[model samples]
Target: MFTLNSQSSVGHNRARTMPTSSAPRLLFLCFTLLSHFHSSVATPRHLRLSVQDIATVEAAQPARHRAKAKTTFFEVDRPLHPPRGSSGPCSTLLLSHSFALTLTKPPVTTAYSPPSCLRGAGDVSLAVLEWRADCHGVQYDRIFGVWLGGAELLRGSTAEPRPGGVTWSVHKDVTKYTSLLATGNSTLAVYLGNLIDDTYNGIYYANLTLHLYFHRKAQSAPTPAASAPADLIVPVSRSQPLDDGLWFVVQNGTDVESTRVTVPANAYRAVLEVYVSSHYSDEFWYMNTPDQNGPFREVTVQLDGDVVGAVWPFPVIYTGGINPLIWRPITSIGSFNLPTYDIELTPFLGKLLDNKEHEVGFAVTNAQNSWYVNANLHLWLDPKASTTAGGLISHDAPKLAGGINSHSLDGIDGEYRATASRNISATGWVSSSRGNITTTFAQRLNFANTNVVSKNGSEQTINQTIDAHTEVGGGGAYAHQLHHSFPLYIFLGGNGSGTSSQRLMRKVQIGFVESRSGAVAGTSTLRNEQVAEAVVVLRDDQVAGASWRMHQVYNYGASNGACYVRNVTSVGYDVLFDHDEASCGGTARR
Candidate 1:
């Protein structure tokens, strides 16, 4: 029962090699909204349940428990196989209620400027799954992910010791994914994206169960479709590929409309989902070398020349591992698995539903190589309510206020220090049921990167670097609002001498938050914050080797100033991890 809304990872277009890298304005309109739809609520009632252990193929389904009698209870358990579009058949496991081994590192994350990520169906109580290994053996990095229907639930690095003998458990208390679980039969899948099937490379044992709770008193016939009976249903315009599964080519510094929609009149809400990725694995070509990885990048959505939204991709691990270099010929250096981003265009529906042809474009910024992107947009209209409308109102492009980067090369020996600063802000007015919704989006970022390298004798080199960044940003409209600031710290410094050199990489993140008002959804409130760190140190001499540590926490509460309920997850290995790290929210991002 993981519950967080989906997390996104940085995607690169399909490229054989990493290449190189590389904005605008809007209008003003002020108008008020018309009517609204408020929500209702209740307690816990399971329609059916089964409490038997799924030890054999025949025992995979849950036992039957009828809601027919009073005082009757149900025991919800894991299913033999997860529903479709889950982790796939290759990674599912049935746990026998035993957990051992210890987590080594939390998870890596990359998020964006946000105010709120709307809620779905319900909040599920999951039997957090935590798995461990005994004498496992493997070198490459495998990314583990969980999904509900088409929406991603979570992603993390795979368990170490490539070949495992015994397995343990690390459970997740997920939030923001009730729709995928509460609805009659929702799909939940978990898998390792390392391209390995369960039958090979390692011995793994898994035990996981998701139990959903719903208020029986408020249950109604399935809710109507998002845009039915009330207004208009229009396909608008689309130029997508016949087979969207195929990647669309986009060279660096260039962008693609890939698809555009001619919005129809009376539209109440417009929803867009962008499927994107990048094609650059320069890290493999020069592991840990300066500039091996691309700078911070954002996915931009534009209406004509005016920019609307920019999203930051989560940084997940894949493509690079301790494997034979020959594998390079077959796969891109970075992960090819695609992640979709959902944008609730409710705030802009007023302008698009005008029955006129409007153009929308999707592009990637700060790209070091090619970018592949496909976009899909859907609209919901209310003929009676949305009449007073117009496009974006009072907005401007983000720019770098100032910063610096300096490097020196003395033959084979070199030293460097780098820093970058940027400021981005936009303000607009949206017509909604709550009257003229004054919406403003703003963001500021500062990054500090430093590295040192030295060559010894014939073919040996020693390198060290410290890279850190901080960001503070958020947005709002009336009583519905949120603001958060976070800092990221990473350390990669070591000396490699021939066969066995000292290698270590450590990263920490603090003060990351996602907060929203119930008013935004025309309902209740929600808040989510993240704080975590990871450590990896290995010395060929064996004296400096250390374990890993990592964690992520989601917090939800009332906007009226109340304490938040936290869903906390932690993982570690032979390392002393700190869950309560200092908050770095004060650092300037603008």
Candidate 2:
């Protein structure tokens, strides 16, 4: 549980007169109480101050921003060190990214002692929390907070009150504050000070939550066709054409387009999607999420299936030629075992830097229950080579082959077996500025060898074998691992140089190896591991202030988990973050 402690200023106060807002003692008290109450089921209380609190917060005076009309009470200090690192080529790859910060007020150190106790696990748990004073009906999770406007930190209440008998209350529900925000006039006077231990301060880890609401303002009746120029483009196939100067439609067809995504380019990998309205009167018509949206996947615009391109977002756009694949079937064995299938869609051949769209077909045995079951192909961009791999023949691969793919199992049964495979060959005609048209075909592995097989719907199998004869031109390989069950142990190749450089792949493969059972009905220990690249993006869109906002995107190169934020801003925004979150039914809207 979280608590707050604030008292009148210690120093001698020089009496000063000024127009001010009242302090909220009742509300602050209520927050303290809620923090303790929510300890069991929910997280500690997120102290949200009202405008009155801001007005009354005094180091010695009533408020500082009294005369200033558009200033906030919370001081948004700049980062100790600017986030700008060595500016290399902006990547459109599906690699892990970091969203970390260095605190300035107290001067945090990188070598701080690791917590002795498991964080966010025991009595003192950590949760990413969020609270919005203005809106409602927004869902937030840790890692990502979605708010449109400014956000603030709510400190404890002030000692004095502003004009009239308007006293602020703590340890109570500040429901009245919402009304003040709706009316467009509200201030928060937080008695900013060092956070205490009893309170949520100094806790290295905590869950982030959100307090949000959505109250729609009345507007004109909706038109059947509310047409506005759309910036979002979903690609259908590799060959469909896209406009050179920004916007255009790419048709989905039987033949996927072949193109070379030259290295070192700034591009966005996104998908074109369709959403059905849930309510007729709903205001927002479409959704733009970094998490959910896709029905087609595992699509490599190559001549051969072995050379695959993975798109991050479903129907991801190809801003360049390089695209990688990040897809694997997860199998569960039990009374309700499902069929297994194989789809080898890695290798491909196409035009260089071509912009086109074409629709591909998708099928699912069960639509309502399992239609999308992550059936869509996995797409990747700007896949980096593994450092461990010694060295390879070339970065661009025409024909590729895969080997030693792993499989996951459940229920101690190889009963319900299934295997799915998809492959596309790569073959292309190339034309150069200083040469004749050349047709390139390298004997690489075809997609037929890669397979996902399970037996009797029980034991699950994943295959990554590519034939040597598959024709691929410009694609490289990457490998990475993901998390599975408990008792985790990862294996590193001898001397950490076990991967191949010529066919270099990102180390993203974590296969479950062995299981140790105990006396307790089914106690067990599992292991999984993979190595891959993690990215960190620092954006700079200079506004008229000392402080700047940073947007971080952490792509794991594969599905792992889901994420969300718990708090909201004065405006409406839900913050959330997670790994391997699937589309729709998975955690946090997938």
Candidate 3:
């Protein structure tokens, strides 16, 4: 069964008055929480603000303007890092041309062949995939996925379009799929499930390409002794493109989407990568009404009939989520590029290598409707052994431990607090050519959410946070370790009694932090924080006067001497300042 876990006190904190200054007090609070993780490191001086600076910023606030729709849309996310100077020339291949997507059409399928220039290349230093799309007219945000040889490579969502048009692009690092790309001839599929009608007339047109950067100097062959990427990728999805998507849909908590597969007898290591998205009534799951389910959900992974792992997804708000005015040009984190979860499956390799088909399943605990779920099983084959033997040493996964407290004067106006947590661990040993390798996996997850509604349901506030830590070890060496934190806060309210001459206000502060270290992938840290506040006046269901402020900071650093820091502030569709730095120097500047 799926479970939830979290740590925090439960209670409703009185709402504070929204700050009127440019330097929002909520931004300071968010920075305070982020500072705890950088205690051992030096935080950029510019990131710290003083009273005088706050006053200066407040004094420079621009005057409110009549809110009007815009034709163009974009985000402040930084572009992908370019190839290093040492890396030689790069080759680009067009994977898909202009492809139109709609609910009446099936997945766009095509054959993929490696570029002739890369056939004799010594080695690839890096590989990147880029997707560009454009749309116009009215439509709701839609989810899409890309697959190569049946293995899902990317999962993302489209931006809500305006009357004129909107265009956006996403770039992703795909070096992990080097083996898959080297295949002789493989089928590539792109699916975007969308509807087109008289009211919703938007259609998505997309293009995709792949770039491979070759190593400047010939590199030595990879050694077979150390733990490396999987040798085979098996898709746990539909076999043929008979529908709009290869993923299975789960409508309720008990629904399970599964697939059967067989692995090679020589496999010694395995990992499952999952992609999930909630839609319909569950799209805003974080703020759902609290009940027996406690306003928390978990995507569970099953081996045969037993639960093995679970994913506590982040709350990603699409462009059309809540009030569209708040996200005009600044989409929420994880909105364009949805995050994927990984589950270490080495402990179950023994059962998967029996030369027989086994079932791999997915389900969402306390789910409502319209959740698309699928996975890819990556298996590492022994280089010198024809068959491998292993056995499960121990397994322990307790059910979630927590509950919800609801206090309400009326059903529509009340406060709800929920908390949950889970601790899981497993150990196993495999005998291969490299020797008897023991693998251990452990995970600790926690979640907490508080919802408050008042003024006869005209106002609502939600504060939620999730913390997760995972570790995978082989023998005495750590293979991988990751720590992630998700913090989200939202306040929605309306002023005036009537629909006309009323004003709507929204305040949101969302952030994601990730730190990873181990032998397999190296060490890296990334943090992205966004804060936005907007007020829109409505006259006859149309925007009249409007004002908004958005501030975002993205910081990333890797052991390979890669660093990217960018900070942006915008007001009323006009960017106040944008600061970018490629080096890990001192602090940023305004």
Per model, state how many residue pairs clash: 56, 182, 9
Which order, best to worst by lDDT? 3, 1, 2
List model 3 lDDT by residue over 1-590, tens digit each: 10011100000000122222121111101111121221221111111112222223223444332223334455656556544543533655555444333553667888888776565322655677888888866566677889888888888777766554677888887766767777758988887766655555677777888877765554444533343346788998876745556777776777788989999999888889988887654666786653323358788888998878889998777665654446666677887788888998888777777999999999887776557789988887887989999889988888766666666654566676777788888888888886888898888999899987778767778899999999998773437899999999988777984646777677889998999998755799999999998775556654455677888999988997788898888775576887888677765665
lDDT of 2 by residue, 49-115 (tens): 2222222221222243233232111111111110122111211111111211211121111221212
Candidate 1 lDDT, tens digit per residue, 1-590? 10111111112211133334431110110112111100010000100011110011112212321111211110111112222222211222322221122112211222211112212242122212233322232223344444443334443333332111222233343323333333334334444322223322332334444432322324323323331221222221222222112234444434555444677554445556555554343111112223322133456767665566554443322323211111111121113233454444555655665667677776654343455454546454433564545455545556422222323333333443434444444444445443554444444444443344334211212121212121211233222333333333333233453445554333333233344433333323333233333322334544332333334443444433333343333332211222321122222211
Q: On a 0 to 100 scale, what is the lDDT of residue 201 in model 3?
A: 68
For model 2 the TM-score comes to 0.21
What does candidate 3 score on TM? 0.83
lDDT of candidates 1 onward, in order: 0.33, 0.19, 0.69
Error of 2 at 426 (Å): 2.8
- Candidate 1 stretches greater than 4 Å from native: 1-161, 165-212, 218-251, 255-257, 261-264, 268-294, 304-306, 313-350, 355-360, 369-388, 398-404, 409-438, 444-480, 484-486, 495-590
Sort the candidates on TM-score, descending order: 3, 1, 2
